[model samples]
Target: MRIVAAFLLLTVFAGLAIFLTFTSSWGSLLIPQAAANEAAVAVEEPTPMPDWEGKFVVETNQPVVLRTDPFVAAQAAGLLRKGEKVALKGCDVSGLWCQTEAGEWFVSYMVGTLPEGLPVLEGVKVQAAPTVAPLVPTADPAALMPTATPAAASVLLMLPTPTPAPTVLPQAIVADAANLRAGPGTSYAIVGSANFGESLSLAGRTDNGEWFQTDGGAWIAGFLLSDPPAGLPVVEPPAE
Candidate 1:
C-alpha cells in the first residue's frame, strides 16, 4: 500500500508538469506584461515619411553635380543648374541624397521645396524690371541739409581703413588612399599616391570638368575629393 501511494503521488506530479508545458497561460506568465505590450507597439508602428514634397527646386549656394549614384565618387551624370527644378523620386536614409524621376541623383541639401504659389510646369520668363527715377531734393530742402565741414572731412579721411582678409583658395584633401595621376583622366599614368586628409592646392580642372589638377602637378578625380570648397576658382585644364 505504501509503495502504491508513493507511485500515485509521482504520477500526479508528472501529469501537472506536462499540463503546464503545453499551457498558453504558463508561457504568458513567464513573459512580463510590459515586454508583450512593447513588442505589440513595435509591430504596429510605421516608418516616418521623408521631409521632401513631390517636387524640389535646385537652390544650392553653388552648382551641384548630378551623379549616377548617391556617393561623391559616382560618375558625374550631369550638372543641375542652380535654379532648375527636378521631380523627387526617393531619398537615401541619410537624407543627404535624392534620386530624381529621370533616374539621376543629387545632393538633397542643395534643393529646396517648390514654392506653393509658383506654377509647376510653366517656363519661367525673365523680364527687365522698369526702373524708378530717383527723387531729387528741391532747393528749399537742399538748404535745410547740413554740409560737412572741411575739418570733419579731413578727420574722416585720416581714419585708417580696415585691411580686407585675404581670400583663401580651396584645397582638396584626400579622404582615402587615392592615386594622383599625370592628367585628369585615368588613362594618364599614376604619379603618386595621396593619403587620407592629404591637402593639395588647386591648380586647374579638366576640359570635361570632371578632374582637378593639384599644385603638386598631380591630377585627382574631383569626385574623389570632398565637395569643392566654396569660392574655389575653376581653371582651364592644361593642353592634353
Candidate 2:
C-alpha cells in the first residue's frame, strides 16, 4: 500500500511540473518568431551626396558661354549665369566640352569637386574643323591669268567644293524608331534612342556622309534621318 501511494504522489508531481511549463503566457513563444521575421526583412535607403548640386555649373563670377559646337571656332549659342543650373547630356572623349540637354555645348567644370568620372564618349572627336576655301592672291586681275611659262602651266588649280545648301533648319525627322549609336555604322553600340517621327538637331556628319551626329554627340544612320540638313562639318569617325 505504501509503494502504490508513493507512485501516485510522484505521478501527480510530474503532471503538475508539465502543466506549469506549458501554462506560461502563450504569446511568449509566438512573439519571438514574429520579431525574428521582422528583423530578417531589411529596408534600404539611398546614399546621400553632400556637395552634389541637382545640375552642373561653371565655377566663375562671370556668365558662361554656350556654344553651338564643341570647338572654339563654333558660334555662341547662348549664355548661362555662373549659378544657373544646366543639365548635361555627355562629354567628348577629352572631356573638355560637355553637351547639354538643350543641344548646346559648354565647358565642363563645376564649383564643387568633379565626380569620379564624367560621361566621356568612347567614339567622338573633340573638335571638327571645316574645310576652308583657298585664299585669293591680292594682285591685279590680269596677273591672275595663266602665263606661257612651263612652271605656271604645270601648277594645278585647286577648286573649292561648294557646300550644299540645307533646305531646312539644322535638324532632321526620324523615319523609324531606333537607338542612336556611338559610331557611324550599324555595328556600333547604342548610346541613346530615337522615336519615330521625332525631330532631332544635327551637329555634323561622317566624312563619307554615311552617318549623322546629333547635337547630343550620339550617332544615327544617315538613312534613318529624313534629309538631314546639308553643309554640316565633316566629322572624324571613331577608331576601330
Candidate 3:
C-alpha cells in the first residue's frame, strides 16, 4: 500500500510540472504576438477631406481680390466685397484656391459656407479703373496766324475729307428660346427669358466663349445665338 501511494504521488507531480512548462512557454510566445496584432489593428489610415460644393460667402473684414489665374501674382480680375455671395465651381488639389462659376479665382481661406436663414451680403461694389483722357498738343501762336496764300487755302479746302473707320457693335438675335441667367453659366438661376428672333445687345463674353452677357445684365448661352461680333471684348462675368 505504501509503494502504490508513493507511485501515485510521483505521477501527479510529473503531470503538474509538464502542464506548467507547456503553459508558460505558450503564454510567453502568444502574449507578445497578440499585443502586436492589436497594435497593428489600432493604427488606421487618416480620414479624407469632405468635397465642398455650392455657394460660399466672403467672410473677410475687407474686400478680397479675385484673380484671373489661381496664383497670387495673377491679374486682379475683380473685387469681392465682404459678405458677398460667390458661386463655387471647384477647388485646387490642396483645397486652398477656389474657382468661381464665372471663371474667377480666389483664395479659399477668405470664404466660408453661407448660412441658411440669413440675408445675403449687400453693397457689393466693383472697382474699375478710370479711363484716361487723351492729351492734345498745344498749338503755337505763330502757327495759328494765317501764313497761307488764298491759292493755298483754296487747295486745302479742295482736299478730300478723311473717312472715319466704321464702329462694329456686337449684336445677336436669339435663334431659339433661351433662358437668361443671373450668371454666365447654365447652373445660375434663370432671371429672364428670350424668345426666338429676339435681338439682344452683347456687352461681353465669358472666358470660354460659351456664354454672353447682355446689356440688360443677364447672361445667355452663346450657342443659342448666331455667331458673336468679331470685335467684341471679352469681359469677366461678376461672381454670383
lDDT of 2 by residue, 1-240 (tens): 999999999999999998888876666888998888787765545787445365543343334557777654456677766556555666787675677768887555422333454567567665543443344445554555555466654453443434544434287887656568888765678788998799998878777555788878889865455555667877787875
Off by over 4 Å in 3: 1-168
The residue-by-residue lDDT of candidate 1 on 86-167, one tens digit each, is: 6666665545466777878765545675334333222212212222234454445435445658869877566565454553
Candidate 1 vs candidate 2, TM-score winner: 1
Cα lDDT listed for each candidate: 0.62, 0.65, 0.66
Off by over 4 Å in 2: 1-169
- Decide which is better by lDDT, 1 or 2: 2
Candidate 2 achieves a global lDDT of 0.65
Clashing residue pairs found in predicted model 1: none
List model 3 lDDT by residue over 1-240, tens digit each.
999999999999999999999999999999999999999989977898543454543454334567776554346687777666665656665455667778887655556743343332233222222232344555554564566687699876775655545434468987656779999765579899999788899877666455688888899865456545433456777776
Better of 2 and 3 by TM-score: 3
Q: Rank by TM-score, highest first.
A: 1, 3, 2
Which 10 successive residues of model 2 have the least lDDT summed?
109-118
What does candidate 2 score on TM?
Answer: 0.31
